[model samples]
Target chain A: MGEFELIERFFKRPARRSPLGVGDDCALLQPAPGMQLAVSTDMLVEGRHFLSTVDPLRLGHKALAVNLSDLAACGASPLAFSLALALPAANEAWLERFSRGLLALADSHGCELVGGDTTQGPLNICITVFGEVPAGGALLRSGARAGDDIYVSGSVGDARLALEVFRGRLSVPAAVFEAARARLEQPTPRLALGMALRGIASAAIDISDGLAGDLGHVLSQSGVGARVDSVSAFGLLASPGIPVDTALDLVLSGGDDYELLFTAPPSASKAVQAAAAASATPITRIGTIHAEPGLQLVDRSGAVLMRRFTSFDHFA
Target chain B: MGEFELIERFFKRPARRSPLGVGDDCALLQPAPGMQLAVSTDMLVEGRHFLSTVDPLRLGHKALAVNLSDLAACGASPLAFSLALALPAANEAWLERFSRGLLALADSHGCELVGGDTTQGPLNICITVFGEVPAGGALLRSGARAGDDIYVSGSVGDARLALEVFRGRLSVPAAVFEAARARLEQPTPRLALGMALRGIASAAIDISDGLAGDLGHVLSQSGVGARVDSVSAFGLLASPGIPVDTALDLVLSGGDDYELLFTAPPSASKAVQAAAAASATPITRIGTIHAEPGLQLVDRSGAVLMRRFTSFDHFA
Candidate 1:
């Protein structure tokens, strides 16, 4: 099939929230009055973002889910998305499963597939997502203040554990590996939790490149330091059978964890918990923002730990 | 350098029209209260979209220009754009030149670089552009009616001539080849002309996959037919020293010509001319939309031309 037919058969859908959808030169979006549009884009490539042997369906879900995680960090409600895909070829079966997984997630979130471009090339999935956030209500990295309590939603480091196993660097039980692999392949975007924390959280970010690196952005942008309780954070590793040091590294510096890492003023701790409950997502407080200037890791006894862990860098 | 540093060095810029720009998880856009957002995405892959030896600067410009062409076709004023790029490596010199060309065109159009993703993979540049049009003012492909006059802005087919020359299929004079290559590399988007013709044009689309195929969209969407004047369209070949038949084929079915193809009523002919003059972009009357259901080509003598032309299809 040609590009047009491929789009028509796989991605085209009737206009929903959008004024115009696929098949148009441009998709027209009418954001409700008084709402600002939140936009984020992510490009996933084979062997870098995903394995070549990955199931197409999971790849599709992970592609959109990762971008939605960005919107979630901004406390935006998913609205629409455009997918620009470069496939090696138009494989009907692969497109069928991929679109099914993609549209299923989009339907669950009411994020319409508006428009995109498709061409022949090395496999790459680029999704640009649009969401809506009320004016002055978006959670941002620049909002973290000293005395804020840092929290993370869902488990962390499971994806990294799965990656380690795939790379033959580690071994785990099949059940543990399967669970971790699922987390790596299909991450749940914390849209509900993010929107619920809109007015409560001072700063927020999705943990795509490990908590240390991702939270570093918030700390740097907000001009604050952070003291993460390593013991508390280590509890977030969902997979079993790993050394404490190795597990701590995965939990703190592992990538592909789509959980939300956010902060709220200590006074708003109760409100943060309420938002977490309302969204049906668990939250764990693991750190504190400080006026000082660097990230520090602490043990259960509040003693500083001397170690360094670098985050994932594609070019490094 | 790391991905974060690379973005900071090259793509990061202070927020302009957007409430938030690069460095944010999601960029926040506050569109004018009464305006509708027009979004479009286009992905360029090496070898398929451009020659590997093409200048990085021109490649960057073309990547965003093609997407902006979609917004222009919808008669939307440029707002901001997100670029998701996958590079094989972080080459400082290439990124510098590429970003310079990309941002130059963006600045000229008053479009800000909002946010995007960067990763290590086979070279791919995906750009998602956002624009704004007054509510109910955006042009569309479904508005054309019988008896509407079809029009196209600027020249066409020069890009195909350049491609053919590059493929060693046809040869042209040095000056002609240079001009044609420029057309292929940096075709001007008709944003001004499109916005100028907003109310006057009934239906519109950007010509990327040649006139025959792109115009086919307008006809199919509007449920109408057209009688294109072959001789008149033949005049649109900006390159010289090409035979009439070959030039006609290139003009009618050449890809990568980012010109605007639209329809306006005969009653709006004067207004269309005024719009062209206002935008300082030349336009030509190529045909008339009819109630019949197929596109036809007629010669200078008004005799039907018996020629079959196929437009570019990536997967075909």
Candidate 2:
């Protein structure tokens, strides 16, 4: 069978309640009353985003997780999603494993697979997720105000280190190798943390393109600036076996962390602390928002550690 | 610069209103109050969906049109979309033309380019469109019931004929060539008819994979069957210079006609007729829903037409 036939036989199925589903021009979805929609799209390519040798399940998981992370950045609850998959040919085994991985994450997140398209080409998977937030209550990158405190959930650089091991450039301990690989393959989306921060955090974003780069988006959009403590940012590097200097680089420029970086007004500091304390997620205050329009890194002595800004650039 | 960097340079731009625009994990959109959402996705691959020599502008238009047609089928007003583009290399002129075509259609349909991903590979373009509909008012494929009259807006088979001509296997008059080629290159999405059908038609779908195949979806979904009058269906092909017999074949299984195929209850016939008259969209009653389950095409003499149930199957 050709690619088109494969999609017809396998991917096309009836939607339980969607007014206009698979065969229509578009799928119709009705959101719960009083909720605004949160939307995100992510694309994964064979060589650029993942290796061809990677497990189909992990690839599917990562694909949905990365997009879900975007929803988390906006403090939106996952709802539904559509996938557009392009592949060289129909492989029944690969489809089974890939769909299993995708459905596993979808079930956990309460997101339904509402619509999608499948085609023939080099392996490329694009997922667009739809979510909901209370009307006028979504966490926005444009909401960060000067004098707000900046926080990051969990540690960064693990994904980058995993990439190093995957590239065979780093000889890591077996335990560390497995842990880092897991982090890269199936990073958890900070959905609860995002929901918790909705009212308290003035602005929020996920660190997909490294903390420095993603934070820059918030700074620029909010018309504010930041002063990140380099020493505090690199604290995770001190964890047992990681090289401090290399870890520092990964922490700054590594992409695909999927950790939420947010800002809260001074009055919300207590609430932020309490929310972080209540959750299983780790939150760290790494810096503060500034009135000036630029990113700065400071050392322990408050000396300027870096004057130039750096982060992952997908196109660069 | 790398592929990712190229995307940022050309495709990424600042949006004044989107709370979460490009460079963030996701986008937060506030649809106008009291409206539900319509979502659709489509993927196009080189050598599969279109020839390599096809104009980039037409490619962009067709890609976006396919998704918009989905929204149209749902009777949803267009809102915004995300694009995932895969290319072999950076071609400035081609990109310019492609974007122009995409933007032109988006502007015409009142949809915005909100977020997207760009990567390097064999040429493929996937677009996901979001639209808005009044709550509980979107059209669906499963709503068709026995005794509902089946209708299709506009003539079919021109697109398939154009492809035949493109492959140099068919030759026709200049007028036929021009009309068919236009239909192939820029198939019009029946947005007006769809909007009119909202709450009036029992079930609806856009005819992308020919009337027989797409209508089969509506029949299967609604748990009903249909006996389309082959002679009446063929009458739609009587326009200009096309022969009746040739048109019948095109109408039956020649896909790529982005027309609305719907089934309306007898009680709504007057309303459907009035709306079609007011909107000037030709609405042809080709068949009627049946209690049994299967699709059949009967000639004037009541003989079953010998035809295969095949259209564009992504997997095939």
Candidate 3:
């Protein structure tokens, strides 16, 4: 059979009651009146994003979590999403487990699985999430101004640390190792923290490619720079129990933290403090925004220690 | 470097303005005001979707076109899309031309190339398109009623025929072969016809997986069936000089037509006719919706012919 015939035989299925479901030039989704739509997409490859040995369920959760985190970055509430999954072959059990994990997350987030496509290939998964925010109210990276305090929620470097362990470069206590591995296997998307920071934080971004790289994004977008105090940044490493230098490296360059790094003006500090107290996520002040347009790391004595460059160029 | 590091090094570029962009759990985009979101996604594998010998530029166009066709199926106006591209290795020239073809289509359609991820793997492209429709207004498959007439825009089976020629199973005049080959290589997206069918048609779907399979979608969604006049369906084949039986097979089962198939109430027939005339697309009445819940094919004498299932089924 030809490609068209193959598509017909394997890809087309009857859609549910979507107002504009598959078969049109585009699928139309009606957002509730007065709501703004939130959109995000993520791609996961077999050996790249997840080990072939990874559980399909966890893989699925990570996929959805990653996208939902983007929605959380904008403080948008989940609405629906479409999935594009490619697999070497159809495995009913794998699909069932994967779908369960995905649906579990979707159910918790109140997002519907509105549409999807499945095809045969080396395993890859791409999900596009749609959410809703109030009009003109999405938190962005461009809003930070000079004198705003920079903050990162929860911890950083656990995933990267876990990767080091996975690659046999680092060894840790059993409990710490398991914890780090779990962190890598199943990340908690900080949607609540993101939503809470919406109005208070001047700018916000999630730490996926590492703190230094992600912070650069916030700074560059805000047209401002930052001087991150290493002492303050290292404070987040207190519980991780690695050497100060090693911990600093992890925090700086280790990726997949999935935590929110944000900036808030002095006027909003008190509100942020209270919000952090009420939220389960830990928040720490790590730096301050500057008028300059580059990121710098400073020692506690205020000496410039390092100037970091961007991390994780996927194509390069 | 490994895959994860590669993603961090290359794929995670900085985007400060987007609520969620690279280096985050997900990227977030704000839908335009007063517009409902439209979404569709498609995955194209190297060997599955295109031959290695095919031009990268054309491959790129075909990839985008398939997803755009999905958007057209829903009658939504295109806006933006995120792409997840996997390649065995980086090819600068291939990337440039492929991106040019993709961006050219995006520009023409007013869709922005908002976000994407690239990685090392076998060639695979997954694109998720975001579009918009007027709030509270979208064409749906479930809206078709039993008495509605079924109509299709443009000719069908040309792509399938072209594929047959490409496979060396058929021979035709050079001009005819090239015309068919063009249809296979670059199927036109019926965007205008879809937009024009909005409101006028009770239900609409694109014919990507052949007439029978796509019609089955409307029938299932609308809780009705259909009776297609085989004679009328073969009208397009008359000028193509192909055998009637072969043409019928192509019409009934061949896919990738990318034509809009819609059902409208009898009262709106005149309006559909007028819209079809005004549209740059050709519209043909090929069938009628039936109160029954299964499809029926009829010959010129109104006698039922052999019924068969037609369309793509991923798992099957």
Candidate 4:
């Protein structure tokens, strides 16, 4: 099939919120008045972002999910997204599964597929997502202040543990492996929690490159330090029976966690809990922002841990 | 350099018209009230889209140029764009030159770099551009009616001719090759003309996958056919000394031409000319829309041409 046929068969949908959608050179979106359009893009290459053994359906879901995670970080409501894909070949079955998974998530979020380009090349999936937020209400990494309470929504480190099993470096029980693999393959973007914390959280970021590394962005941007409870973070790992050191390593440095790490002032503690309850997403207070200029991991007895953890870097 | 450092060193720019650019999970844009956001995305893969031997600068320009051409087709003013790029390695020299070319064109059009993702993989560049048009003012491919005067901005086929030279399929004079190569490497988007033809043109599309194929979209979408003058199209090929058959093939079916192909009413001919003149972009009236449902190519004597031409299709 031709490029147009591929798009028409699998990707095209009638325009809903958009004035024009697929089949147009450009899609037209009218954001509500006084709303700021939030834009983010993520590109996933086969080996770099996903394993070759990954299912096409899961790949599709993960591609859009990662971009949505960015929108979630900004506390933006998903509106629309564009997918630019390059495939090695025009495989009908793979396309069917991929599109089914992609559009399923899109429909659930009310995010319409607007426009994109398809070509013949190495498999690459790039999604640019659009969302809307009230003017000046976007959660940013630079908003954290000293004395702010640091919290993380959902769990982390499970995705990294799943990666280890996939790499054959570790083995786990079948049920545990399946659960961790699911977390790695299909991450849940904390959209509700992000939106709920918009006015409450002083700073927010979705954890992708482990909690410590991603939180480093918040600390550096906000020009503040943080004191993370190492034991508290140890509990963030969902997998059981792992060594303390390895668990801490995965919890602190694992990549592909789509949880949100955010900060709110102590005065907003009650309000933060209320927001979490409203969103039905669990939240855990694991740290506190400090006026100092470095990240400190403290043990249960309040002794600083000397270990260092680095985040994933594409060009490291 | 690490991913964040690479982005900070090269791609990050201060927010200009946008509320945020490049530093956060999402960039925030607030369009003027009553304006529709025009969105388009294009992915350029090495070997498929361009030669590996081509200069990185030209590659960068062509990437953004192609996407801007889409916005132009919709009569939208450039606003902002996000670039998702995957590179095989962190080559500082290449990145410097590429960003220079990309940002130069972006600055020329007043489009800010908002947000995107960078990863380690085989080279792929995906750009998602945003533009703005007044509500109900954006031109579309579904509005062309029978008796509309078909038009083309600038020229076509030269880019394809350049590719032929590169492939050693044809040889031309030094000047001719350079000129054709320029067309291939750095085709200008007819943004001004598209904006000017906002009300004059009934339907429009950017000539990317050759005129015949791209126009087929307008025809199919509008449920109309067209009678294109083969001789008139032959002149669109800027290269001289090429045979009529070869020239016609390139002119009618060549890809990578970022010119505008559009339709306007016979009554609005004068207004179309005025629009073309106001934008200072040359245009040719090459055909007329018909009530019939098949494309017809005619010679100067108005006799139908029996030859068939297929536009570029990635899979085919």
Candidate 5:
């Protein structure tokens, strides 16, 4: 079949919720009055983003999930997304499973597959997602204030622990490895939590590049300092039974958590707890923002810990 | 430097016009009141979409230009775009030139750089563009009727001619080759012509995959047919120093001509002419929509020509 026919058979879906979807040169999205459009794009290449042996369905889901994580960080409600994919060849079975995984999450989030281009090449999936938030409502990295409290939703470091297992650097029981693998392969974008925390959180970012690095972004943008409690943050690691020291390292500096790292007013701790409870996502307050302009990690006794670990750098 | 720092140093700009730009989890765009959002995406691979010898600057420009052309087909005004790029390594010189070309075109069209991801991998660029059109004013393939007149903006076939020269399949004089090469490399997305035809044109599509193939999309979507005049279309080929027979084949089915192919009611001929004149892009009347449901090419005496050439099929 031709590219058009292949898309019609596989990617094309009913444009019920969208003003227009797939088949047009450009898809139409009629935004609600006074709402602003939030956009983000992420690309995953085989061997770089995932192993060649990874499940096609999980890969497909992760492609869209990563972009949605960006939306979740901004407190935007999911609207729609476009996927640009390149394949070495047209494989029906692979596409069927992949689309099934991708569309399932999209349906759950009420995000339509708006439009995208698919071509023949080495396998690559690039997803650009569009969401909407009321004007002046989107959470920004620059909104953190000196008195804000730092929090992170969901347990951290399981994804990195999973990668370590995959690399044969660690040994784990089958069940523990499965749990960690699921964490790496099927990250949940904290959409509900983000929407719930919208007016309460002062600033937010998704933790893709570990706590230290991702929080560096918030500090640099907001022109403030942060003192993360190494004791609390390391204690929050859910690394699927990895050794304590290794788990601590992963929690502190490993990447691919896909959890919301945010700041809120110190007095809003109860409100923040309420927001997390409403979304059914657990959150832990691990630090406080400061008027100083750098990041520091503190021990349990409130003494500064000086051992530094770099964030995951794609190109260092 | 890390990927995030690389983006800040090279790709980040003032973002004066956007509601929100880089350094956020997502970029925010406020659409004009009473307007619909138009979105399109395209991905380019190194060896497939362009030659390894292509200029880095030109490659970046072509990448964004193609997505803009899709917006043009919908009669949408340029708004903003997100870029997802994967590179083998961080090369400062290459990035400087690429961003220069990409942002230069973006600035020219008033499209801002929104949000995207950068990673280390095989060189690939995918751009998703957002635009706006009034409700019910978008030009769609399904809008064409049986009795509409067909038109194309700008010249075609020169891009294919340049490809042949690049492949060493054909040779041309130095100056002639340079002119055709420019047509291949730096295609002008007929944005103004598309906007001007918003109310006048019955249907529209950008000719990325040649006249015969791309026009067939319009017919299939509209449930109509088309009969292109081989005499006029072949004559319209602006192949620099190419032989007549080669030009005929290229004009019939050569891809990568980012021109607009459109249809309009017969009575709107004057309005179509006015659009072309106002946009300063030449237009040619080369065919007619028909009740039959297939494409045909007619000779000078209106006799059907049965010869066929396939469009560039990604799978093929």
Candidate 6:
């Protein structure tokens, strides 16, 4: 079948939620009145962002999930998104599985598939998501302040552990590897937690490029430093079989964790915890924002640990 | 320099118009109250949509321009857009020219550069543009009705004429080739024309995949047919030096003109003309919508010509 036929059969859906959908040159959306639209775009390439053998179904899920994570960072409610896909060839089986996976997640979040383009080329998936937030309510990196308590929702380092196994640089038990791989392949966006923390959290960011590096963004933007508890950070790892020493490195520097890392005033600690429980996600207070301008890791004795903020840089 | 530094030096701009811009996880936009958001995405692969020999500056402009064309078809005013770029390397010179071209057109249309992702891969550019139109005012392809006068804005076929020369299948005079080449590389998005046609147009579409094939979309969706003027379509060709026969073929099926094609009632002809005059874009009556469900082309003798509606299909 032709490109148009493929899209009609697989990607096209009724514009029930949106004002218009796939058939038009442009899709129409009516954002809630008085709310500001939040927009973000993310692109994932084969081999660079995923394994060549990944399930197309899972790939679709991850593609939308990653962009949703950005919305969560901004405390925005999903409205709609567009997909720009480049494929080597139109494989029906792959398209079927991929669309099913993508549509299911999209429906769950009420994020309508608004519009997109499909072209012939190397496999690449780019999604631009639209969302909404109340004016002045978006949690920004520049809002973090000294004396704010930094926290992370959900476990970190599991995805990194999975990457190590995929790279053949480390070995783990089969069950452990499978669990870690799931973390890497299918991350749940902390949408609920993010929305809940909007009025409570001072600043927020989703962890795609490791906790240390992402938090560094908050620090740089807010003109503050961080004093992280290395032991507490490593203790938050989900891998019970792996020793803390090894997990510590992954927890500190490895990437691909979609956890929400945020800061709240010391007074709002209870609210932060309540937001976590409300979202059914765990919250860990691993660091504190400080006036100094460098990220410092400290052990229980309060001695600083040597650290370098090394996150995944696509060009690097 | 790191990713953030590169972005700052090259892409960072003062958020003059958008509610919030580049540094955030998601850019925020406040659409005018009661307006619907118009969104579209298009991706350009290095070897697919454009040639390696084309100027990087023009390539950047075309990438965003194609998406803007979609908004124009919808009769939406330009708002904001995000860019998802995948590059083989972070070449400073190429990026400098690219950003310059992209930002210049965006500025011209008052479209803001919002948030997006950048990574390393085969060179690819994906842009998601957002716009706004009054509720129920968008000119859609499905609104064409029987007896509506079909019209095309500006010239056609020049881009296709340029493509033939690039393919080395034909050659023209140096000046003629340059003019055609410019059309191929930098065809204007008829944004003002589209916005002006808002209440006057019964249905509208952008000529990305040639006049005949793209108009088929209006016919198919509207459940009507069209009787096109073959002579007038050829006359609309901008290639003054090209032969009529060659121009006829190019105007009919060559892609990437980025012109607005629409239908209006005979009663609204005066308004359509007025809109064209206000927008400073020429409008040509090329066809009429019919009750039947097939696109029909007729010569000066008024005998129907067989039309297959062949357009650019990515997987074809």
For candidate 2, write residues A203-256 as lDDT tens digits: 999988777888888998899999987434343344576666567777878777
**Each candidate structure's count of clashing pairs:** 0, 22, 32, 0, 0, 0
Give per-residue CA lDDT, model 3, range A1-316, as digits (tens): 4333433443344444344443444456666666666777778887777798988788888998888888877777777778788777777678767877877887787776666677777888888887777766778878889999999888888888878878988777787778877788788888888877767888888777888988877876678999888433343344555676777778788877778888899899998988787667788888899998878788889898764445665555
Residue-by-residue lDDT tens digits, candidate 4, B129-238: 99999999999999999999999988888899889989999888898889889889888988999899888899999999988999999999999999997444343354
Worst 10 residues of 4 chain A by lDDT: A230-239
Minimum summed lDDT over a 10-residue window in model 1 chain B is located at B230-239
TM-score of each: 0.98, 0.92, 0.89, 0.98, 0.97, 0.97
Q: Between the candidate structures 3 and 5, which one is better when assessed by DockQ?
A: 5
lDDT of all predictions, in order shown?
0.90, 0.80, 0.75, 0.89, 0.87, 0.87
Tell me, per candidate, how large a share of the native contacts it keeps.
Answer: 0.93, 0.81, 0.53, 0.92, 0.86, 0.84
Candidate 5 structure quality by residue, lDDT tens digits, A1-316: 6787778888999887788999889999987888899999888888877888888889878988988999999999999999998998889989988998899999999999989998988888999998999899999999999989999988888788788889999887887789778889999999999999989999999999888889998999999999987434342244345566667678878788899999999788999999999999989888999999989888778997776667887889
Instruction: Mark the 10 consecutive residues where model 3 chain A has the least summed lDDT.
Output: A2-11
The local lDDT score (0 to 100) that residue B170 gets in candidate 3 is: 67
Q: Which pairs clash (backbone N, Cα, C closer than 3 Å) in model 1?
A: none
From the highest DockQ down, the ranking of the candidates is 1, 4, 6, 5, 2, 3
- Candidate 1 — which residues are off by over 4 angstroms? A230-240, B230-240
Candidate number of the best DockQ: 1
* Candidate 5 lDDT, B132-250, residue by residue in tens: 99988899989889889999887888788788889898887777688778778888999999999999999999999888888988998999998888434342244355566667778
Q: Candidate 1 vs candidate 5: which has greater DockQ?
A: 1
- In the predicted model 6, the residue pairs found to clash are none
